[model samples]
Target chain A: MTFDWGFVGEAMPDLLTGLRYTVQATVLGYAVALVVGLLVAIVRRGAPPLVAGTVHWVMEFIRCTPLLVQLFFVFYVLPGVGIELSPLTAGVIGLGLHYAAYTAEVYRSGMEGVPRGQWEATRALSLPAHRVWLAVILPQAIRRVIPALGNYLIAMFKDTPLLFAITVPELLFEANQLGGQYFKYLETMTVVGLLFVVVSVPSAIAIRLLERRYAAV
Target chain B: MNFFVDALPLYLNGARYTLLITVGGCALAFAIAMAVGILGSTRSAALRALASVYVEVFRGVAALVLMFWLFYAMPLLTGYRLEPVFAAILALGLNIGAYGAENVRGAIKAVPRSQYEATVALNLSWTQRMRLVVLPQAWAQMLPTFGNLVIELMKGSAVVSLIAVSDITFVAQQLRTFTGETVLAFAAALVTYFVIAQVFVALMRLAERSANRRLGRIPARPRRRAKPAGAAAKGGAA
Candidate 1:
C-alpha cells in the first residue's frame, strides 16, 4: 500500500530503456504500415476483380482475428517454414501488418473521398496513372486522412506492449520484470500506467482536434 | 490431417472457454458502461468527474498493462489476488466499458433536443422522460457502436491466454508446444476467432434491424439504399 518514491527513482533508468523500445518499434512499425497499407489500398482499388476480391477477403481475415494470435503465428509458427526472425523483427512485422489492414481501409476510403471530377480532369488531360496519383489524387486523399492515420499511430503506440508476449523488452514488459524481481509492483505498474496516460491522453485530444480541423476544411 | 483430427478436442475445448470468457466479459462490460455513461452524462459534476476518471484511466493504458496491474500488482497492494479468469473478465470489462461509455454518452447526447422539450412540455418526471422518450432513442443509437465494442472485447479476451487461461490462443500455443504443428494449431484458432467476429457482426446487424423495425424506420422488409459515400468509420477508436 505504500508508495515507494525511492524505488521509482532508482527504476527510472531501466523504465526509460523500455520506453525507448516502445517508441522505436512504434515508429518503425508505423512506417511499415503506411507503405504497405498504401500499396494494399492501391491494389485493392485498381487490380483485376478476382485479385481485388481475394485481397478484400484476406484483409477481412486479418481484421477479424486477434493481433495476439497473429503475433504468435509470426513469432512461433513462421520459424517452422524456415522464416525465423528475431523478436523485435517479428514484433514490428506483426504490429505493422496488423495495422496495415486497418490503414489500407483508411486509405481506400480517403481515395474514394477524392472528387470524381478530379479523376475526370486527370483523364481529360490524359495524365499518366502514376502521375495522377502522385500529383493530384494522393495529395488531397492523404491530407483528408492524416487524422485517421494519426489515430492509428497512437493505437500502434499503445499496442507495442503486446510485444512483451513475444519477449520484447518494451515498457510493460519492463514493469513486469521489475515487479517480479523486486516484488514491488505498486511502483512499477503505477509509474508505467501513468507514463502511458501522460503520453496517450494528450495525443488523443490532438487527434480529435485534428479531426475537427479537417472537418472544417 | 491426422494430427488435426487428434487435436480437434483440444481446439474445441479451447474455443468453448474463449466463448465463455467473452460472454462473461461482455455482460460485465455492458453493465459498467451503462452505469458510468449515465452517471457521466448527468448534471452532477462530481459523478461526472469520477466517471470520467474511470474512463480515462481505463482507456489510457493498453489492455495488457491493465490486466497485469490487476493480476500481478493489485494483490501486492491490496492482499487480494484475482483468479486469472476473473482478472481477465474484470480487465476486459473495464477496458471495453470505457469505450462503451463514450458510445452511450454520445448516443444520449445525440438524441433530438425536441424530444427533451416534449418531455418537459408533457411535465414528465425525470425517470419518466428517460424511460418513455430518451432511452429508447438513445438505445437504438447505441446498438452499432456497442456491437463493435463487443467484437473488440472478444478479441481482447485472447490476451488472457498469455496469463495461462487456456483460451483458444493458449490451446494453439500448447498444441504447438506438444506436437510442434505450428500451422495447424494457429490456423484452427484463427478460424474459430473469425467465426466469433462474424457472429458478433451478424447479431449486431440483426439487433440494428429489429430496433429500426420497432422504431418505424422500416415497415417490414429491409431495403438497401446506397449511402452517399462516406467512409465507414467504425467508432470506438480509442
Candidate 2:
C-alpha cells in the first residue's frame, strides 16, 4: 500500500495536544524529581545510620523495580485506600518518584564531587547547616550536576509513555487511542516517534554542551 | 490477602518467568550491542552514519513505545503476528542495543592513543591490534557500564506485562485481580526486583575485581599525542 501523508496531517492536532501533555508531564515530573531527589540526597548524606540506611534501601528498591508496575500500583492501590488522583497526577508522581531515585544518585555524586576542603571552609566560617547547604553546597553541587540531571530529564521524558498503562492522556497513549480509533497505527505512531526525536535532539545537544563547559572549567 | 499467602507457588512461578525474560533479554542485548558498537566504529562514513541514526532513534524513544509498537503496531504494519514473549525480547534487544552501543563506543575511545601507536610499532594488523590490544582494555572498562545496562534491561522487561507476558509484574496484577490483595502483590514485585538488582550489583563488583586482577600487573603508560602530520593525513583520508 502507498503511504498517506494526508492522514498524518489531519491527525496532527490530536497528536499535538498529546505532545503538549507530554511536555507538561515531563516538566512537572522533572521539577518534582529535582526537589525530592535533593531531599533524599541530604537524608542519605547526614541522617542517623538507621534513617540513612532506610533511605538508601528505599532508593535502591525504587531504582530496581519497573516504573510500569509502579504506575499500576499507584493507580489501582491508591484509589482503594481513598487517596484518589487523576491519572495524570498519578503518572506524574510515578515518573517523578522513579526518576528521583536516580537523581538522588546523581546528587550523591555531585556532593562527592564537592571537595572536602569546601566542607571544611564552611565549618570554619560557622555557617548554619541549612544555610551552608543552601548557600554553599547546593550551588556548587547543582552546577556540576547539570548534565546528569539533564540526562534524568531526558529519561523522564522518554518514560512518560508508561503513563499509558494508567490511561494517562499523554502523547503515546493518545497516539495509541488515535490509532485504535482510526486503525491508523502507521501515521500516529510514526509522528509520535518523529516528535520524540525532534524534541530530544536539542536536549541532547544541550547536555553535551553542558558537559563540555563543565569539563573545561 | 489470605489467598495471596496461600497462592505463593503461582507468584513464584511468575518470578521465575521474570528471571527468564531478564536473562534472555540481556543475552540478546549484549550480542546486538557488540555488533552495533563495532559497526558504528567503522571508518566508512555511511556505515557509521547509519549506525549512529539507529542508536539515537532507539535510545531516545521510550522503551514502552517500542514495546507497544512491536506488540501491537508491528502486526498492523507488517501483517505478521508475534507472540508477546518474542515481541518483548525484540523491543528490549533493540532498545538496549542503542544505549549499549554508546557505552561500547565510549569504552573503545577511552583506550589511550599511545597504545594504538605501540600496536602499529609492533607491525600488528588492524584486527590483531583491536583483538590483542584495544578490546581487552575496552572490555574491562565497559564491564561496569554494561552491568548497569543489564540492570536497566531487567527493569525494562517488566513492560512486557502490557502484552500479557506472564512475568512477575503480570503475575502481580493477576494476584491482585483474583485475591484483591493489592499491597501483598505489589510488595512481592518490589522485593523480587530488589533481590534481582542486588544480585546484578554483586556480580558486577566481582567481575570488576577479576578484571582488575587480570590487567593489574601492568601500569598504564602515559597517553602519547598523535603527530600533527599523521593526524592531518588520517583526517584528510576519512
Candidate 3:
C-alpha cells in the first residue's frame, strides 16, 4: 500500500507504449470526427427535408446514447454482419462517430455565426457554391470554432481510457494489466491518473489561451 | 423482438440503479460545485488557489480512472472498501463537480457589479446578499449548463459497470451473453439511456422556464406580444 518508486520505474516502459497508442487513437479518432462532423453539418443544412430530418435524428440518437454502449455495439454486432474489425479500429470508429454528433452541433453554430452579409456578398459575386463554402465560409467558420474543437480534442484524449473495454492496450488498460500482474492497483492506477493530469492540464491551459486569442480577433 | 421483450424487465431493473447513481451523483456534484465555485470567485487568494487545484486535478483525470482508483486502489490506502454504487457516485460526483464548478463561478461573476453594490448599500451580510439577490440570478444562468452536466454524468455512469455495479450497461452485457443477441441487447441499452437523457433535458427546460418566470423575465400568461405592448403602456403611464 505504501508508495513504490521502484514499481513505477519498472512499469514505465509498458505505460509509455500505452501512451503512444492513446495519442494515436485520439489523433486518428479526432481526424475522423472533424471530417465526418463537417459533412453531417453541411448535409443537415442543404439536404432535402426528409434526408436532413433523418440525419438530425440519427445524430441525436448517437449523441444521446452512452459512448460505451456504442463501442460494444460496434465491436460485437459488426462481426455478425460479416464486417469484422480489430479492437483498435472498432474503438476509433465508436469514438469518432459518437463525438461527431457533438462536433456537428459545434460546426452548425460556427456556420450560423457567419454574418448574413457575407453570404449575400457571395451570392452577389456569383460565386459557385463549392467555392463559396471552401474559399470563404468554411475558412471563417472553422477559425472561430478551433478553440471549441480543441476542447473536444482534449476530451477525446481523456476518453482514450475507455478504449480498454474493447481490449485496446491503451494507458488505463496497461495500468490495469500491471495492477493484476503485480497486485498493486494503488501504485499503477495512481501513476496512470497522474499521467492523465500531466497531459490534460497543460492542454486545458493552452485551450484557454486559444479562446482568448480568438475572442480578441 | 422476443429477445428484446424478454430482456426489458432486466434492463429496466438495471436502469433503476443507473437513475439512482445519476441523481445521487448530481446532488453531490451540485453541492461541491456551489462550495468550490463560491470559493473560486471570492476575493481571497488562498481560497481561489485551493479551488483551482481541486478543479484542475479532478477535471483533468478521466472518470474511469477515478472510479478504478476509488474502487480498487483507495481501499489499500484507507483500509476500507466502498460499495460499488457508493464508489461510482463518489467518483462521478467528484469528476463532474469539477466541471460544474466552472459553470457556477462563471454565472456568479456574470452578475452585474451594480447589484453587488446595491446589496452592500442595503447593509446585507454576505450570506444574505448571496441567498437573496446574487444566487437567484446566477441559479438561472447555471441551470442550462448544469443540465448538460447531468447528461454527461449519466453517460459517465455507464463506466461504473467496469467496477461490477450492475448498471444498465452491465445488465446489457449480461443479456448479450445470455441471449447471444448482441444488437438487440445493446440497442435496447442505447434506447433506454436516450430516453433517460431526454427526460433530464425536459426537466431542465421546465426548471429554466420557472426560474425565468420567478425573475419576471417572462410573462405569467402566454400572450407574448400583448404583454410586451402592455408593459410599454404601463411604462408610458408611469
Candidate 4:
C-alpha cells in the first residue's frame, strides 16, 4: 500500500523499454500525419468540388469521433476486409489519420495567412502550378505553422499511451502490466505519469518560444 | 443487421453512460477552470503560482495516465477507493480543467483595463466587480473555446471504457466480439459520438448567439464554406 522505491527500481528497465516504443510510435505517427495532412489540405483547396467536399466531410467525421474508437476500428475491423495490420501499424495509422484531420486545418490556416499578393505574383509570372505550390506556397506556409505543428507533436506524445489498448507495449501498457503482476500500482503508474511530464513540459515551453518567434514574423 | 437489433438496448445504455460522463466531467471542469483561472489572474503571487502549478502539472500528464492512477493507484496511496465512473470523471475533469483554465484566464484578461477602473470608481467589492462587471463580458469570449473543450471531454470520456465502464465504446467493443460484426459495431458507435458532438456544437453556437445578443451586439452571419481561423488552434494536450 505504501510507495515502494525498490519496486520502482525493479520496474525501471521495463518501463524504459516501454518509453522507447512510446517515442517511436509518436515520431512515426507524426511523420505520417505531416505528409498526409499536407496532401489533405491541398486537395481540399484545389480539387473538384465533389472531391473536396467529400474529403472535407471525411475529415470532419474523423475529427468528431473519438480516437480510441478509431484505433479500435482500425486494429480490429480492417483485418476483416483483408487489410491486416500489426498492433504497431494500426496504432500508428490511427494516430496519424486522426491527427491528419487536425494538422490539415493547421496547414489550411497557414496557407490562408499567405498574402493574396503572393498568389497574384505567381500568377503574373505564369509559373506552372506544381512549381508555384512547391517553390513558393508550401515553404512560406510550412514555416509559419511549424510552432502549431510542434504543439500537435507534444499532444501526440501525450496520446501515445492510448496505443496501450491495442497491445502496443507502450509506457502505460507496461506500467499496467507491471501493476497487475505485482499488485502494486503506485510505483509503476507514478513513474509513467512523471515520464510524460518530463517529456511534454519541456516540449511545450519550446513550442511556445517557436510560437512567439513566428508571431513576430 | 440482426446484431444491430439485438444490441440496440445495450448501445442505448452505453450511450447514456457516455452522456453522463460528458455532463459530469464538464460541470467539474468548469468549476475548477473558473476557480483556478480567477486565481491565476489575481494580484496575489502565491495564488497565481498555485494556479500555474496546477495547470502545468495537470496539462502535462495524459488523461489516461491520470485516470489509471486515480482508479488503480489512489487506493494504495490514500486507502480511499473511488467508484470507477467517479474516478473517470475526476481524472478527465482535472485534465481538461487545466486547458479550460487558460481559456478563462485569457478571456478575463482580455476585458479592457477601463472596466476595472470603472469598478474601482464605483466602489465595487471584488465579488461585485467580478460578477457584475467582468464575467458577463468574459463569458462571451470563453464560449467558443469552452465548446471545443466540451467536445474534447466527451471524446476523452471514451477512455473510461478502459477501466470497464460500459460507455458506448465499450459496448461497441463488446458487440464486435459478441457478433464478429466489427465494422457495424464501431460504425454505430462513431455515428453516435458524431451526433452528440454536432448537437453540442449547435448548442454552443446558440449560447454564443445569446451571449452576444445580451451584450447588445449583432450576431455575425454563419459562414458556408471555410471554418473560422480559430478552428486551426483546436488540439490541446487532453
Candidate maximizing DockQ: 4
Candidate 4 docking category? medium
True-vs-predicted CA distance for residue B122, candidate 3, Å:
0.7
Q: For candidate 2, give the docking quality class from DockQ.
A: acceptable
Query: Considering summed lDDT, which 10 consecutive residues are worst modelled in model 4 chain A?
Result: A201-210
Query: What Cα-based lDDT does every candidate model obtain?
Result: 0.84, 0.78, 0.86, 0.89
Residue A131: error of model 4 in Å? 1.3
Expressed as tens digits, the lDDT of each residue in A150-207 for candidate 3 is 8888888888899999899999999999999998889989999999999998988988
- lDDT of candidate 4 over B1-238, digit per residue (tens): 6877888899899989999999999999999999999999999999999998898888899889999999999899998999999999999899889999988988999999999999999999999999998999999899888888888889989999999999999999898888888899999999999999889888988898899889888857763434422232245542
Please give the DockQ score of every candidate, comma-separated. 0.52, 0.37, 0.43, 0.63
The prediction achieving the highest TM-score against the true structure is 4
Q: What C-alpha RMSD separates each model from the true structure?
A: 2.7, 6.8, 6.8, 1.8
- Native contact fraction (fnat) of model 4: 0.70
Least accurate stretch of 10 residues (summed lDDT) in model 4 chain B?
B225-234
For candidate 2, lDDT tens digit of each residue in B1-238? Answer: 5665776777688778777877877888788778788778768889888878877787777667877777766676788888888778878888787777777877888889999899999999988988998889888887777777777878888888887888888888888898788877887887787788778877876786677668773436522211111111111100
Clashes in model 1: which pairs?
none
Worst 10 residues of 3 chain A by lDDT: A57-66
Clashing pairs in 4: none
Q: How much of the real interface does each model capture, measured as fnat?
A: 0.57, 0.40, 0.64, 0.70
Best by lDDT: 4
Candidate 4 reaches a DockQ of 0.63
Which stretches of candidate 3 lie above 4 Å from their native place? B219-238
lDDT of 3 by residue, B12-97 (tens): 99999999999999999999999999999999999999999998899889889999999888998999999999999999899888
Greater TM-score among 1 and 2 belongs to 1
C-alpha displacement of A74 in model 2, angstroms? 1.7
